[model samples]
Target chain A: MDNLNFDEPTRKELQTFIEREQAQSRYNSTVQNMTSMCWDKCVTGTPGNSFSRGEASCLANCVDRFLDASIFMTKTIQDQRARLQASQPETF
Target chain B: MASRKEAFMNTIRNEIALSNAQELLNKTNEKCYAKCITKPGTSLSGSEETCLARCMDRYMEAFSIVSRSYQTRLARERDASA
Candidate 1:
């Protein structure tokens, strides 16, 4: 194994890498979740030949739909907040 | 800690990290095999090999796509709350 010591430039690079990895920790979990979900949805074939066009579409759609769900939730919450503000009088 | 035993411990640590990567690789191989190779022939058939290759590609692609989407969602959620 190559020894990686903390020199100035190396240290800076490592710091950046660590930060990215930190962010990626959150990202990695979602990938696992999506893989599990999409595997169930798309990979129905008898594990032979290859993924059909249908399976590929299903995997892509699975990710898109999950994002759609989050977006829908955001809009719903915002609308509720707006309604509450409009109903409250003399708050200012 | 800079003794022979320390060096041995480091080797163990390195092995653990390598094994983790190996485990993922093995899992991906098994999963893609199951997805692409239905029948167990005397040898891997031509079509079975092609399917295995494609399944591996798609799996990696899906993993990356999911990673990106999840990160984007997290950023949006943070902005929304702030």
Candidate 2:
């Protein structure tokens, strides 16, 4: 594949296109995961043409809260690591 | 070489489309089966057919709602982080 499509500028273009596509693919999968998670939490009742007000709000809140929780946990872990480093002293 | 490249591009596009379609189909099947197949009858009845149709429509609606909600959240996060 590389040998067949070898040109300086064209190769650079294809590489960038591939990178963009890879990023989009990752972004898409994240969305898919979020959808599945939120759907399970929010859409518990029998399927209907319209969602009740409570269900709609739950769906919106689910996404925001999930992302918030993820960020908060990551920050908490980093903070704990920093605290540990600060507390431990090296004498050796 | 050009034809091969075209073929490769076509394959990628087709794969992406196929996966998206498969995802929709699976969601529809699971939701519809749950909603419509309440009782294992000798055959599919009229009410079950109606329920399955409505269920598919509702599933698509749920998909759109979730998609919008997530997209908005992503945009808001980007703005805040920026």
Candidate 3:
């Protein structure tokens, strides 16, 4: 491996390729994480041949609502920080 | 040089693919086992095998549903922010 030195152009190309692959891998892991989390929340009953309508919809909504909760919490934290900074200007 | 670059790229691609596959299999194993095997028996009974098979299919179906919903929400959020 030590003797394998890529030229400048090749290096740049590989850098972008690796970055793209890394982003894809991150996306995949996020999907995997949400799948398991939602499965636990939605699929409580015993396994059947197919999902009931209620279970299917619950699975879908679980994913959306989880993201919504995350965004809501982030906004709330930022708002709280702003209020604190505004109220205690001289604390710095 | 070109051949070496190709080899390197293929290695990275295969590694990522392999990891994603392993993660899915691990999740299926964990979830299906929990669902289908409520008690530890000396062996997997006939009904338990049926349940496990159904459970695996349903888990995968649920996974796809979650993936689609998440992707749609992400796109919507991106549009909103943009």
Expressed as tens digits, the lDDT of each residue in A1-92 for candidate 2 is 48666667656756776677677667666766676677778878776677889988887788789988998999999999888888885631
Tens digits of per-residue lDDT, candidate 1, A1-92, equal 12543456555655665566555554555566677677767777555444577776677677878778877999999999888889985682
For model 3, chain A alone compared with the true chain A gives a TM-score of: 0.91
Among these predicted structures, which one has the highest lDDT?
3
Model 1 gets an lDDT of 0.66
Residue A78 C-alpha lDDT in model 2: 95
lDDT of 3 by residue, A28-90 (tens): 999999899989998999999999999999999998888889989999999999999999989
lDDT of 2: 0.76
Residue A45 Cα positional deviation in candidate 3, in Å, after optimal superposition: 0.9
Better of 2 and 3 by TM-score: 3
Model 2 iRMSD vs. native: 2.4
Give the Å shift of residue B5 in candidate 2: 4.7
- Please, what is the whole-model Cα lDDT of each candidate in the order they appear? 0.66, 0.76, 0.92
Can you list the residue pairs that collide in candidate 1?
A47-B34, A47-B35, A47-B36, A47-B37, A48-B36, A48-B37, A48-B38, A49-B36
Alpha-carbon shift of residue A36 in model 2 (angstroms):
1.7
Error of 3 at B27 (Å): 1.0
Residue B9 CA displacement from its true place in model 2, Å: 2.9
Highest-scoring model, DockQ: 3
Per-residue CA lDDT of candidate 2, range B7-57, in tens? 766777677778877877886787679767988899999878877887787
